[model samples]
Target: MATRPIRMFGDPVLRTRAQEVTEFDAALEHLIDDMLETMDEAGGVGLAANQVGVTKRVFVYDCSHIEEGLRGHIVNPVWEAIGEETQIDQEGCLSIPGVQKDTERFQTVKVSGQDKDGNPVSMVASGLMARCIQHETDHLDGILFLKRLSPELRKEAMAELRNAEWNQEPRG
Candidate 1:
């Protein structure tokens, strides 16, 4: 496994909705492995395939810091809000490095998807785990966490992103 470059925001791949994975193969496995390595190296809880320039529905996450033992990759994931309640917290993205905004997310969620090998997997998540799942799934759907921000906050985030030093640097 190798660390792949995390595609920064404004890259077309991040805006394009990812295609569902139909064949579970080595290429998919490689992407997943690389995504995991990239996320770890970048110190992010979650990294989507699209965030790494792959337009396949896949994401790797390690939310163990916030929720112990909460880590893995998911392919073709779908999640449902579990309750009427919501939680607002500061959320960041690997694609849009250095900018975090208060975003609202469900209190709990039920996610179902397949593993890299095409095996079915499902889980119930709350707290940061649920938030990470929602955030990564949004990437697969071409939605950024900035979209979840309020008008004022989004404007602030946009200005911040506009001037981020990383924006001028070359990405691997």
Candidate 2:
């Protein structure tokens, strides 16, 4: 598997909705592998296909740190609210580079999706993990975390975004 270049916020591809994956074939698997590699290379907890200029309904996240004992991936995922909407938490996006801002998200969530092998799976998540799932899945739908932030917060993050360096080097 090889790391793919992550598209930054200004890229139009990040704003466009992704297409559904109707065929789970070799190409799909390869894309997933590449996504995982990209996420790891970027030191991000998650990534979406659109982040790599591929507008497809696919994202992967590993929130083992937040949830403590749980770890996994989400493919073609959908989420349902499991609890009250929570206060805004500071969030950063690979697509947005060094930009980070406060955004509101659910305190708990129930998501359903398929595994890499095309097996159906569902799970409930809370706290940071829940917020992360919501954030990453939103990317698949062409929604950026900055969109959820207040205008002032978005403005404050602009400088950091401008100063941030994109990881253009290839990762093995």
Against the correct fold, how does model 1 do in TM-score?
0.95
Winning model by lDDT: 1
Q: lDDT of each model, Cα atoms only?
A: 0.92, 0.82
* Best by the TM-score measure: 1
Give the least accurate 10-residue stretch of model 1, judged by summed lDDT.
63-72
lDDT of 1 by residue, 82-106 (tens): 9878999999898888998899999
TM-score of 2: 0.87
TM-score of each: 0.95, 0.87
